[model samples]
Target: MNETVNQPTYKRQRFLLSFVHQINGSVSVTDLQKLVFLHMMSEDSNYYEFIPCKYGPYSFQLKEDLDILQRGGFVTLDYVQGSERIKATGDFPTGYFFRIPTERGKALMRRAYREYPYYSINSEITDRFFQGEELEQFNRGKQTYAQTEQVLFTIGYEGKSIEAFINTLIQNNVRLLCDVRKNPISRKFGFSKGKLKHIAQTVGIRYVHIPDLGIDSDKRRSLATLDDYKHLFEDYEKTLPSKKRFLDEILMLLQQNTRIALMCFELESNMCHRHVIRDYLVRTNQVRSVDI
Candidate 1:
């Protein structure tokens, strides 16, 4: 270990390090994702949340942390098998971090596929491990997120993980997430505009930032009750009629997309300005609205 390893650590980073060390000092990227996914699925004590990716369940946050450890000299990377040609430029081959699994990693992969069938929905290799009921269950879970209906949804990301928030969109079959914040940003991981957009589209949900529909940040600073929100929204509602052009755009998108979601930052629709927008669409365009 280096002096950098002596520095105080983030809990999640420590968890990742411990996980990698438990299996050995290293693991291939895919198997590590699967292992972490299985651990999270167990006992409901999740240390990280994952989104489905090309191979299966994946966590970008975990990948970033691994890079942090490698840079701190707490870990090393080396290419395995076919990945040898894809070396990192002027560095210790970060490509090595994405290698084929070791024998231990392979065992973990087999275990994860058997235990967490849902996470294996998009698996590149786990398909060979299943047949009969296991295969049917996996196929069923794969289609769980596929819904097609013309329902309008309103959702907020407060007090939820990115995984939870995205899961809502996926579960409701929301095709587009219309962000209704004046400032499309958040301190939360995967909730800021760029990251949120990337995460949404990664899971087949489109994202759009409709900042024109946002309440001013200065206005949202001190709302303490439903009455306060009501008072603010009464005035806020007056401005919507004048912003009809943007509302028209939203209506157009909803019509074209089949299913869309309005998103802001509060957990409850009653506490957020998005409810006002949802109501406006409901009353004027006859858009079906569901607070999620």
Candidate 2:
């Protein structure tokens, strides 16, 4: 027997599948619900309505839509057993995990992401729900995406120990360390290219040295004041267009790695050529910069 489904209901099912697919193929049921709730709160012309529930918000229709998708083979759900610790405490903590969509489901999601790219990114959706303290804490934790378009970060190690520097990278969940120094040598014991690479590798962080992105020692050593830095950056900016190969190499790296830290020696980003590199990336490549 063939059963008929309403257009609205069918659209919602596709939307749900697309949403799950957009968030890296799988998400915990709670996160999926929260993301949907947040999306509805953000967009006035959203598909779902919700009433308040014990866990912040509730949408029975959303659950029904998911079930419909599951029955039609658009999505699959698996029950993850509760942890032993929770069982010992006499409280079970089972989780519902959803798998990636089927081939047919993926086709629909690809179309959905194209139609709704703003809602496709996990960071974009999660950023809306985190508040002051929570936001700070979340930023301090590992970030989820590395190849996030138009996003970059810069860091200075002038006043930091290697341990502190690595900790900062880990805190921010930086996966790649881009050394924008012409000479990867430092007076600091642990900061030389070889040593730094070893340390980064020990902690599962990738290290890359891009000399073309750095200023020559003569220009760097000549800087004595803010005006000098300003002039140097101005001159450095002029050379960026000619360095297309290096710039493309960096863009490729960013595409491959999620979070990258542009490392240099100045304590403040304002005093270093790395900032100029960051600005160049942001201006030329249309990326955003976060100084961490």
Candidate 3:
């Protein structure tokens, strides 16, 4: 939990590098991703979560973690057969691989595709990894999860890895994400604007950030009690009229897209300003908002 020259600042980052260490040899980035994806399934920790991607189960947050570890000199990476390769290096924390040994050799990747067909839905190489009956089975799993229901939603990423957060979005078939953060920046890996937008686009979800709909940072500083949050959001409600155009724009998005979620930093909808916006939309348009 503490920052250091030899340690990854977050548990998730450590676990990621631990997988690289488990390999004991350089692993292709693609294979490392599949390995970690498979590992996350076996481990109960929400330290890392994943979304189905072009290369099967992928975690944008994990990618960011590797980048950070690289910058910190705890890992090494290079191009391998047109894909990036990863390996543990000097000062990398050793013996931290958490999960009991699962599968090894070729079975790991095969198991990843075979067992988790949903994750391999959009996989660019599913065909190569599986064939015949297996290929057909994989095909059956490729159905898109996006839905056509008119709903407003609120989701907070307080304790979730970005991968877990996006996984939730993909699972709920959320078509658009309305970010109600005033600054659209974060210490969290993928929630920051640029990274968040990239992840959204990768998963075919739209991202919209409306600073006007957010509670300013200065006012968010020392909320030590429920009464504090009450006053903070109460003041947030008063600013809605001045932010009417932004509210209408979000409403239009939900109207047009059918499934839109308001995103913010708190895990509980009650603790985030996005809930206030959700209330406003629901009261005005008679559309209910679900907390995700």
Q: How far off is model 2, as Cα RMSD? A: 19.4
Give the alpha carbon lDDT tens digit for every residue of 59-106 in model 2.
555766776666655556766563110001111122323343333323
What's the residue-level lDDT of 263 in candidate 2? 90
TM-score of each: 0.83, 0.49, 0.84
Best by TM-score: 3
lDDT of 3: 0.80
In model 2, the runs with Cα more than 4 Å from the true position are 1-150
Which parts of model 3 are misplaced by more than 4 Å? 1-18, 43-47, 90-93, 96-108, 131-133
The better-scoring model by lDDT among 2 and 3 is 3
Rank by lDDT, descending? Answer: 3, 1, 2
lDDT of each: 0.75, 0.63, 0.80
Clashing pairs in 2: 146-258, 146-259, 147-258
